[model samples]
Target: MYCETDDELVELVERARKYTEDGKVADYIPALGRAEKCDLSIALYYTDGRCFKAGDVDKLFTLQSVSKVLALALAIMDNGEEEVFRKVGMEPTGDPFNSIAKLESQVPAKPLNPMINAGALVVSNMIEGRSTHDKLGRFLTLIHDLTNNTSIDVDHEVSDSEFETAHLNRALCYYMKQHGLITGDVEDLIDLYTRQCAIKVSCLDLARIGMVLANKGRDPETNRMIIPEGIATLVKTFMVTCGMYNASGEFAIRVGIPAKSGVSGGIIGLVPPSMGIGVYGPALNEKGNSIAGVKLLEMLSQRYELSIF
Candidate 1:
């Protein structure tokens, strides 16, 4: 009962694969290093329990920065948006995701918003828990609750790979500590943030999470609240405003969904009131967005008329 017929969805998948054939996979993380270039897939899940998938939909990939949306939403629910704002600003940085320029500027030293790496690290610290382990436990629970997927676990290999190369994020955490923007142990928070980013998921899981948000934090299938309504809207606003790094404006103009992308090359987007959609193309544009992913979303948005505006 999930789809009336998967034929149309199947056609879209074929188009996506053809459109993304030249895209490259992410290689920074050594574990993602050897992933096949042009590896593309998508999953679409509607509120009615119909699911459509195509291509390498089962392929496992790191959540990367896409985890920011969940962390930020949970932080706001745990401590209120006002408190979370004290640690991370809502304004767009207009700088690179890993840029330390804003961190060093007295004009606005705080990480701009949770979608960026620095801001996500700050948001991770704000999740209520006694220790990093406790915090991640809550995080894992949140993801599991949202996706209704119990088999999910941290990809230790990916986590370790990110940890080794996350020097920039670590430095940003240390600087934030010096600025009183982050009050916890810097090293601990950075490690916690890095670990959280390493949670592996597929297009199905990503689409399910997006579906919950599209349903205003309610699980469409179970009709249970996964995220509170208010916090869901808040997180969606942030995603719309700042989700795609410096390219968020362009994405909003084109794809017109409150979406988030991971450096691992996945994009989770939604068409509110209709469905949750996911696109995976590891080849990234210069802005760190998935080039093929963006193209596919633009076409989908145009065909479906899903833009909020």
Candidate 2:
């Protein structure tokens, strides 16, 4: 067995802790700037009914871009794939998650994929609701359902920080609106997207959510479907293609699991129908994923034979 006990997993996490020192904590968002830079943790929940946890598993952190997956899923449910596709493309941009060049030069100015900020903002706009608050409530509800944790809440300070520093995303939203790719109020959509990104969770919460995806969007423990099959497939495809910012391709080859990485130093990866692994290491590499997290997942995937490939 790869990590027979929590202690073994803790040892592996400690061994990889050095990688976190190689990266920097996200400072762009002032609230996220408040997180401990050296925080490191891992949590795993297997569909076969095994669980392992190590390190700062109880520390709460903002979801950051990871919330894009849930927002994309809900958007697809509200509007079919084609309609959502109009606002966001399926192709990976291979650029920075917040790259403005892709938005300015791309056809239709549709965001390359929902995993990126532009695409996520576009998708967030399409969430069917009367107002930004309503849409955010629904998005949080979906996350809660998937994790079966009702206490999940947005950190308003983080949301406020992101909202204040969201110039690029705001510009992207305006560009999208001008191109007619996104309808309704641009600021409203941006606010909703920012709020979604600020939602907080721990490694344990993330592992549980990953477990849902691992089981094809079903709550493996509850035996309930949390997401439609079609939407789950779409989300998983996007995760494989664009989850790890610009390093998604490299990660897919090396780590080989459907995964999503957030700038907050959270990475959620899962082997289909098998296991979900969540890692939190606040230091970020050049590609914006947690450095220690990437290394740990690469090793764990190999050791556990958890790669989809």
Candidate 3:
């Protein structure tokens, strides 16, 4: 859907910036910790190629956990859904995104959903790559194809920084291996996950990819299927239920759209049959969501009746 007024959207972005000061930029990883906490941006792309952007639309950021969505899609495409689902379950854990508490207690020991670190590691390892670099190339190619932007690539420094501090991720991978949920080299899978998480993109890049999902997996310009409709639907449902860390259900209630959020403070919201929206505010709340971005989405959803419900 076309925005009612570009000025209105711009004004909303300005208002949302105030909340950014209350948030904390991620600091666990050295590279991500360097982001300016107040930086904020948003871009919205319609199916017809029209676009509306506000704030720092060109500011670059790593995809972080937002990469999980695409990695899961690629895995499902390489292997059928049944085979992939056998490796990961389709439910929310209600625990932290990286928590292994559930895995310790659950019987199957599969990740609750592909949005979490554990699940993403599993899918990244399944990307049909003979080597880690090849898997990265495949993931990059998928992002370029979906966004129609060939310039996007991984932020190698960020990936390297993440790899250095990925002790917890390494532990999760090993645990999965011991449970037979994952059957690969733990080091290789962690490398794949870390690199994918460090893939570089701006708000505009994310909006285009979201537009493809909004259009039911078909490229609006070429009418070519990027993914099967059923697959897109499955991924979107995961976004609604578990995309955000622990705040997913609250986000769904407030914004009422399918969405995924990254610790880098990027969020991709899919408004079916209309627009794909991308937001980046490098200031996260307690649940690892962009404090300002979520506020902006909530306001926009209310102002335009953008909620699917």
**Which number leads on TM-score?**
3
Steric clash count of candidate 2: 0
Query: Which candidate achieves the best lDDT against the true structure?
Result: 3
lDDT of 3 by residue, 1-309 (tens): 458556877888999999999999999999999998988888989998898899988799999999989988889999989999998889887899989887788777888888888888887777898898898899999898899989998899999999999999998889989988787788888888888999999999889999999899999999999988988888888899898878888888899999999999999998998699999998999889999999999988988888888
Off by over 4 Å in 1: 1-5, 18-22, 106-108
Candidates' RMSD to native: 2.1, 1.2, 1.0
lDDT score, candidate 2, position 106? 78
Tens-place lDDT digits, model 2, residues 1-309: 456799878777888888877899899888787778778999998887788999889899889888889888998899999888867788987789998898878766677888888888888888889988888889889988987789999999999888889998888888878888778877787788888988999998888888888788888777888998778878988899999989999998898999999999998877777677788998999989999999988878777777777
Which residue pairs clash in candidate 1?
2-50
The reply for model 3, stretches above 4 Å from the true place, is none
Extract clashing residue pairs from model 3: none
Off by over 4 Å in 2: none
Positional deviation of residue 172's Cα in model 1 after best superposition, in angstroms: 0.4
lDDT value, residue 71 of candidate 1 = 95
Worst 10 residues of 1 by lDDT: 1-10
Ranking the candidates on lDDT from highest down gives: 3, 2, 1
With a 3 Å backbone cut-off (N, CA, C), the pairs that clash in candidate 2 are none
Prediction-by-prediction clash tally: 1, 0, 0
